[model samples]
Target: MATDSEKLGIKIERNPPESKLTQFGVRKWPNRWGCPPSKFPWTYDTKEICYLLEGKVKVTPDGSSESVEIGAGDLVEFPKGMSCTWDVSVGVDKHYNMG
Candidate 1:
């Protein structure tokens, strides 16, 4: 987990056991999102939790040169008000929920 005064809040559990995260149930986050290799900007209006099922991505927060790499089997959390650019290197597939 990491946080910054002017940037986003992110909590990542790398390679967590599938059982631990899956217990939350897919029904809770029935929507799935996928993107081909590309870069795009996004803003989180609400806190979000996502489970990556495939592919890889590098997320760079707005105005910062720093970034985080995420891939399959990763559990990621993004706090509300965080704005960032997602640079998908190998495309992406994930299940997500907002609250």
Candidate 2:
């Protein structure tokens, strides 16, 4: 089963089957992002869902020490207004779009 956790408005769903995600229209996201290992900061103005196709990342929300690790086959949601830093430890490729 997929596991989901929410804190400070971010949500992560681990290891969700691709079929189930497709059924929910996950593939409809218009953008595909690919990045080499790096660290960057971001802020979301609208909710965003990311479906990882490869590699991994750790997202640390601004002002919080806690972080969420995401990788291939994972589904992650960043809520509106959240500020965070992404540490792409293994680089990554994913489909993402605003919700």
Candidate 3:
């Protein structure tokens, strides 16, 4: 069964499980496949787990204006009340299930 999201040329791996954004009451995607060479604009999420699957990204946590490089095989647990930006440098492909 294909979904509207699966047609985006990206696939989400379901394994790590889903999580919830306690602050905003929003669901966080446990995995996400950002388009290749795609640049995720400056946005912030209260709580989420950014897992690297097949690319590189730079994230700037809220309060602290510093961008950290995230690569494949790496996992980042962004705490709540944290605002930040994401810049996808390389391929963006991940499996994410949110709460």
Give stretches of model 1 more than 4 Å off: 1-8, 26-28
Sum up the clashes in candidate 1: 0
**lDDT (C-alpha) at residue 48 in model 2:** 90
Summarize candidate 3's per-residue lDDT along 26-93 as a digit string, tens digits.
23544455676765444323444545667777766546655666566544455544456677778776
In model 3, the Cα lDDT at residue 40 comes to 49
Residue 17, candidate 1: Cα error in Å is 1.6
Best by lDDT: 2
TM-score of each: 0.85, 0.89, 0.52
Of 1 and 2, the candidate ahead on lDDT is: 2
* Overall lDDT per candidate, in order of appearance: 0.81, 0.86, 0.49
Predicted candidate 1 versus true structure: per-residue lDDT over 1-98, tens digit per residue: 32222224678877666566668674368889999999999999998888888989989988888988888877888989989999999879999988
The parts of candidate 2 lying over 4 Å away from their true place are: none
User: TM-score-based ranking, best first?
Assistant: 2, 1, 3
* Candidate 2, pairs of clashing residues: none
